[model samples]
Target: MKFSRRASANWKGTGADGSGSISTQTGALDKAPYSTKARFEDGKGTNPEELVGAAHAGCFTMKLSFVIAEMGFTPGNIDTKAKVTFEDGKITNIHLDLSATVDGMSEEDFQKAAKDAKENCPISVLLNTDITMDAKLV
Candidate 1:
């Protein structure tokens, strides 16, 4: 199977005052707002790091679901937060915080599945920064 996605950005004027809108192929983000202030300072819009965090969190959750099912367990629910750190114009770290509920699963097994998902998920493999996870089964 193969898949491709696209997103575009359009901006005008200088970096400090310039503003842009980002659009994605899936229409999930249609002209989402972004600006220099949004990236470097406090602004009323979204930034690249925020979007990346969202993507990572979503991807990790899906991967965990698949992993749990593969282990003969049905997941009740999984909550994940991916914190992306951007410093000095570079991405430093991605920390994944995950909590899950699954029936008839041991804490040790759940942690193993979570670790596997964090290491082998497509986005995790694609990222070049440090990745860490804090996973718990509840």
Candidate 2:
């Protein structure tokens, strides 16, 4: 099966001084503000890298949950944070920091599951950059 999602952006004026708003098909973001300042400096609103990080973290966590279940372990709680490193006008790296609690699962098994998730998550596959992960069974 295949699925599609949509988001739109509208920008006006020049690159450095222009401002934009992003909107999603679900209305989760209805013309939300974004700008160069928000991306490069301390400013209000959100940026593409931040959005990518959120998506990556969410996808990896969900994938890990399924992987744990497939490995005969019950997943309790999983938390992941993705840090997307954007440098020199390119996305350089993405690092996932994960902490998970699984029932009757050893640290080695948890690490294996997390590694699988990090490598196979949809967003991870889509990104063309270095992906590193730190997974801890807690």
Leading candidate by lDDT: 2
Taking all chains together, each candidate's TM-score versus the true structure is 0.95, 0.97
Candidate 1 structure quality by residue, lDDT tens digits, 1-138: 998989998898898899998889999999999998998889878888889899999998999999999999999999999889998889999999998899999998998999999999888988999999899899
| Candidate 2 per-residue lDDT over residues 17-129, each given as its tens digit | 99999999999999999999999999999999999999999999998999999999998899899999999999999999999899799999998899999999899999999
The clash count for each model shown is 0, 0
Off by over 4 Å in 1: none
Error of 2 at 31 (Å): 1.0
Task: State each model's C-alpha RMSD to the native.
Answer: 1.0, 0.8
